[model samples]
Target: MKPRLPQLDRPVRMPSRSRILAAVIMLAVILGPFVGHLLGAGHGQAATPVEPLPLDSLLRQAEDQSPQVLRQLLLALVMSLCCTAIHLAVTVLVVVSYESHSLMAWASRTPLGRITLIAGTAMVTFLAMFVEILSWAALYLQQGAILPVEEALYFSSVTFASLGYGDITLDLPFRLLASLEALVGILMAGWSTALLVAVIQKCLALRFHRTDHGSDPTTATNP
Candidate 1:
């Protein structure tokens, strides 16, 4: 007799309601400040003026202060890695939860359902990115690199998006961190895009498979 192989169709474990509630609370904590910052934008006391410096001047300063730049770069890299890991975790959690609950099977049955799935995934991706930006903003605020909560959030958002609107700028010593954030943002954006594509492909495949086999595409044996 041949040895039994592990089953590929083993049931996925859905997260409990308590786990889902915890995840919701965590998202609220991460995104609350951003919502508050937007709502209270004009009501708050004026942020102290931060003069923007020319890029060339900032570069020269960084060159002259190699040790400080190196330290800041290392810190930025560490933060970027942390943010990436957090983003990946969020994406995996969402995908797994959806799959475990057979949401993919339900969504694959209709065009509208597929659209909703894609839209929901996009929103989650945006939220994850915002959470990362807020983390960097919190770091900037804590370090006294940007004093006002609103300004820190704004600077971090623009920096992370690589917008560089020139309306807000970090000091020379901390400027390298902004560059790192921009790089991370680009990578995360690409990652999110790829995730969306993969999700769409899965949905399409499941839809076709269910149509042909007359079986629930997401069905699995219970453990």
Candidate 2:
């Protein structure tokens, strides 16, 4: 009984090494685009500046030849991959930690702690996705094609979620990149939700055990 109870009451071990690795991965992902852009900009191809496309035309072009237009597309792809990797790593962290925390709290634990952590992590992930979307919108807008912040955000959310409402259709070339964002977003959201639920259930079970489970079933039994 003592051993089992103590085991259940132990705190989860944080993976310091994994977290450090995650940080490195995240940094690399973030830098991939800028690095790609620099490298792509200086490639051996002979370059001749040409008349810039008109706003609408450029926007269309950017949308269509996204790969050709921004050297960052490749970088963005790599960045997205990094984000995915970090996302997965963080997820594993939360799961392992939550389990450990639950085991430690044992009979006295409640779902509140786990809930808070899950919610916090999810919120951060949500923000990260939005930020990535905003970066793309800003890049395009810099090229003279403008979408309202609200509209861009909406499209971004939908894209990230992979809902593909089709209400605000991006140009053909842009669509491919957008799809990638959507896929990443969907996977991240799903993973976050699963971890959150698991933590919540564990927390709730502890609460139940301490409350209902500890109660005398016959306390209210008629004498």
Candidate 3:
């Protein structure tokens, strides 16, 4: 009788405390504004609902000179920088995961693996943008620009996507934030696209290399 080799089961890796804490902090930043709004309502102090101002009012507010505009611009600058830093950090983490986990090898072995990698990379990018948008929504609420947290977040999402639905409008001071967020969204989308393309290229090259090295049988063999 032939001897059978024993199979070893792969160990599942549990998330470390630091990683779990980081995730919690990310979620808190994303949902804290909404939670606070709910708490305020429960305490018998409901936030004033946001109402769109008339065009004349909006234009007048826009033309009025104030230091609030400067403050808002500075805030926008800081938030943009923070979002950029986070996006870059996420890119670094993705690249690190790919290398550490030998994702290229897995990708080269199967088309499904490559697709999974692409989907995962995209999800990470989406999550990074969500956090940034939520931060801006929280800031808008804090600045009292928008009355309701949900309205602020809705505005943030619309502006981030550059949808410009115009159902809700911000005064000039806070409008600057929306403009900056739209620009950030465009830039981040470009960055993510580049990353996805690079990953695809790497995966394809890995497969080519394996075939050239005679490791993969799909390549044509020289007669």
Query: Which one is best on lDDT?
Result: 1
| Tens digits of lDDT, candidate 2, 132-216 | 5666566445533335777776776677777878888776446556766777677767866776676566555555555777642
RMSD score of candidate 2 (Å): 23.2
For model 3 the local lDDT of residue 40 reads: 81
| Tens-place lDDT digits, model 3, residues 51-118 | 87999998887677457777767898898898889899988988787664345556668778768877
TM-score of each: 0.63, 0.47, 0.63
Every candidate's CA RMSD: 26.9, 23.2, 21.7
Candidate 2 achieves a global lDDT of 0.63
lDDT of each: 0.82, 0.63, 0.79
Give lDDT tens digits, candidate 1, residues 25-95: 99999999999998687455446555889999999986889988788888888888888897788788767
Worst lDDT run of 10 residues, candidate 2, spans 214-223
